[model samples]
Target: MIRHRDIWRALDTLAERSGLSTSGLARKAGLDATAFNRSKRLTGDGTPRWPSTESLAKVLNATGVSMAEFVALMGEGNAQALGQRIPVIGYAQAGESGYFDDAGMPVGTGWDEVLFPAIGDPNAYALEITGDSMAPAYRDGTVIVVAPNQDIRRHDRVVAKTVEGEVMAKELNRRSARRVELVSINRDHDDRVLAPEELAWMARIVWASQ
Candidate 1:
């Protein structure tokens, strides 16, 4: 049965999964912040007020969440509604070898994984890229999913680790005997060359939903 409560529940679940309140979700969707407020869910005469399709679509797009997943979230119990806990590590710490335990498990706290997308591989990790350093292509606050096992090729966007313990995302230009040539997506940023010894690890950018 299609009930107004179901729709409300779905929105609530989405808010929780995204770590945002109902009003926050609405604002993120470019809607009036009060659009999803509980008081706005009903009319003065007690008629159920449902969100417009446009509003719902906006929320889905903003959250990078698919419709199928949204529906599934709505159907789940409150405990399950909190979303799956995946390893959430900062972009700066991604290159640290021991940040993840020997078993490839994430260690420490300040990690909150929400339901954004299902990275099929258990070893897959995500890093929320900050700043416009790689912009004109990748904007600030873009979340990039890195697949360590994925093959990296020339000209591909990659997240590479340096022996100095720094991690940065740049387009792979070419690899030579002495160094690697990397291009910056944002022309404002200069390209870089790293000596062989400076490179520790590199992974191709599997997906970026920004």
Candidate 2:
């Protein structure tokens, strides 16, 4: 199956490795900032949004990752090639009350459905941005992939969930004895420091569209 979720996850990984958010990735690729945003993922009636070939090529070029590498990141390897199948849903509906469980796993309910060729791994999922706080780097409606199994390194862009129930995307700076520092990709955004106790979970960004 050509799962779209897998492609999204791969993009998230690439962003993290390059220290960029979805919007940052789009900027690096010379595309519109919202090219990868969640809002653009669907039409008002709900549809599977697709990226232009030119944009995809640009993203691949900016990341310096080959198509094979991207496919591998999505866990399909070269044994299978991407088809037209993709999973579709509204960005606003992705994080609805029942869409995710207490552990943040996809619960597969309350979603406005649409369909595309399956091109990604079933285990992979997408997250929709709900606010403009990450603007210039990520606009409202940008969909981000969280690859929990991917290795996280210093300077990587990450989606961090705090114990207080806050989810934020920022660049991982340094970890000291008791605190973690994160740098925002947007110049207007300030860096943040959090105590270890405030951290509940952190995942590396694998891929983003815009």
Candidate 3:
């Protein structure tokens, strides 16, 4: 059953994913800035106060999130509707053994889990940036969600693994059956061109937590 806590948490999640604070979300919804504030979640007597239906609708519309998504966010537990629990590893550790298979799918062990928005790809994983090489575009500590099932398009940001166990995130300058060209966001880093034999696998970076 839906509860006050779940509803409030759902709002917080919605604001977070929308890149807004609760007040910011409220303001954007044309409501008072404190509408979804924690202090307003309870009355002066500390009793629960639910958000009005009108306010909820406004927030959903303001964020371009449907009612279904908002209700899913209020799920009781780790329901499929909540999101996917995908493997997460640091970019620095992606080159290590036992973390992935030749197909770029995560395998073996030593992987942590992070809840990511469902994008219909069970093989999706998250890579936490650990260096400045991918900065400005992907700063250190940012988490990038990789979708192996997604088609890699030219000029798309991608994460690739080399046959030599090297893993790097770069923009796909060009792609062909035999060779692919990569351009790094950092100017100090040299771009690369590799043949099929040199690249183990490459996947498009669908989303990132900056």
Candidate 4:
């Protein structure tokens, strides 16, 4: 059965396969740049606005995708495929309340989501970089996949959240029973030595959407 979310995910997947954003895809197809935007997916009265066949055909032709290829893309992100999706949020919002549980698992609502090829932990979530602080290694808007249940090791990129509500991304230098030593992702930022007792949770950064 075709569901509302399936069509949206298929559109997003199509855009990804073509190396374009949804707006870019629409523009490339000679449609309004917002044609496939999430905001345009529903009417003002809240009815779903299914993509018109004409628009679909235009996009398919523009991307050189056959009907069969489009159908295949539609099937690629069904419920079974969401096993690889992780709830994502901006780094600025990572420290906000109700977004994470005590163990740092994603818990609350309003999470922007993404489909990744692979994630080591089922409970893993993603963080979108929002500033220049993590430059050189990670640029603004970069999406990083983090696994809260994974073991932290030396040289592994990590996401650490503190009890005072600070969340940071850095490289693991060393971890002992008491404290964790970390190197800054940007050299301009100083290194850190965090006491484990002061941390809410710390986890390994497993993948990135570069």
Candidate 5:
């Protein structure tokens, strides 16, 4: 799993490679000069505060750094490091408060954590499968890593949470300005098409611990 320090290390590396300082890098990315300052790396409570996806996107664009290369700059692997983890929760439990914020990013410390592979997105999380809704493709006990910042395209498997707190994993059969058509993995389950207003946020499924 990518740890907090890993992210900071990557940003610093990006600045060094660009012949600039952290503040300079942030400025080039159209962010405040102190955005990447060490003092701003943590919150008042000392908890780690990761760079937002929007900010990271800007930095990558400004530096011409591909997501793959940026992830590589995070240094060596830490999956073997005991207790180093990322947020995870059961599928049904996601509807409950405190697990996810309004943007569908994991928030609060109530979630269970597990070591997962690097996926480019700092806010990536895992969801344990719970029922037959996405069986065959993803049955009960399967743990899927979700990349909220990953690009979504046709035929990509995705996890979508609705405004009513309903979450479903489905294939992106088609997406348009007004409707999102999803194909269910289980033949027994009917395909679904949701209106733009029905979806709160939809993220791509990057990995499955099958």
Candidate 6:
């Protein structure tokens, strides 16, 4: 007895779990960009249109979600999928004392909380963007989830803190024993490289609410 609305909502949940929009999810599944769009959910005659089983199966495969998990998202089991909470702080306050540890993991008090799909990292946290400094890519008020223990790789967006207590969100270009090269998220800023000794720590940004 799966309702049409339930199926649609399950798709929305899957998109959110993967940090993507409905169109993005459709593209990832190799379907038409409007496959999961609301306009396509109703016929021209105003009749409710249901998603095909084939499309659902393809989405599940592309997102690495099992059919059981998709069904769970449509039912009371949805709670189990989105209940993980992480400490949150304003990006502007990230450099303040008592907000982070030496390793750049969030610690201490004054942190708010935000619920997200399970990221499986106890050291994960969220940062609320406060200004247009990271515009276009991450606008003001966007919530980005950071994974401190995740491996930082080339071309990944990251939150980095320097030993002098400045926090920056940039894209990693290269990293070596001596220095790390980073490209600014905002095009107005110039690319820079800093000695490894100048940075306190760095963490990968895993997800962002855009």
The best candidate in terms of TM-score: 6
Q: Model 6 residue 7 lDDT?
A: 82
Give the lDDT of residue 86 in candidate 1: 53
Q: Which lDDT values do the candidates have, in the order given?
A: 0.73, 0.66, 0.82, 0.80, 0.82, 0.83
- Evaluate model 4: give its lDDT: 0.80
C-alpha TM-scores of all predictions: 0.56, 0.51, 0.66, 0.62, 0.60, 0.69
Question: Which numbered prediction scores highest in lDDT against the true structure?
Answer: 6
State the local distance difference test value for candidate 6. Answer: 0.83
Candidate with more favorable, higher TM-score: 1 or 3: 3
RMSD of 1: 10.2
User: Tens-digit lDDT track for model 6 on 52-152?
Assistant: 75687578768877544776788695545545668888887898877888888787765777655566788899898888888888888777889999998
- Per-residue CA lDDT of candidate 5, range 50-109, in tens? 998668867977898755567667775433432225688878877776678878898877
The TM-score-based order of candidates, best leading, equals 6, 3, 4, 5, 1, 2
lDDT sort, best first: 6, 3, 5, 4, 1, 2
How accurate locally is residue 72 in candidate 3, as Cα lDDT from 0 to 100?
Answer: 76
| Model 3: per-residue Cα lDDT over 101-209, one tens digit each | 8788888655787665466789998898987888787888777889998988889989999989898999999887888999987878999999978988899988765
Error of 4 at 28 (Å): 20
Where is model 2 more than 4 Å wrong at Cα? 1-104, 107-123
Model 2 superposed RMSD (Cα): 13.6
Candidate 5: clashing pairs of residues: none
Q: What range of 10 consecutive residues in model 1 has the weakest lDDT sum?
A: 77-86
Q: How high is the lDDT of residue 153 in model 5?
A: 95
Off by over 4 Å in 3: 1-23, 26-79
- The true-versus-predicted C-alpha distance at residue 97 of model 6, in Å, is 1.4
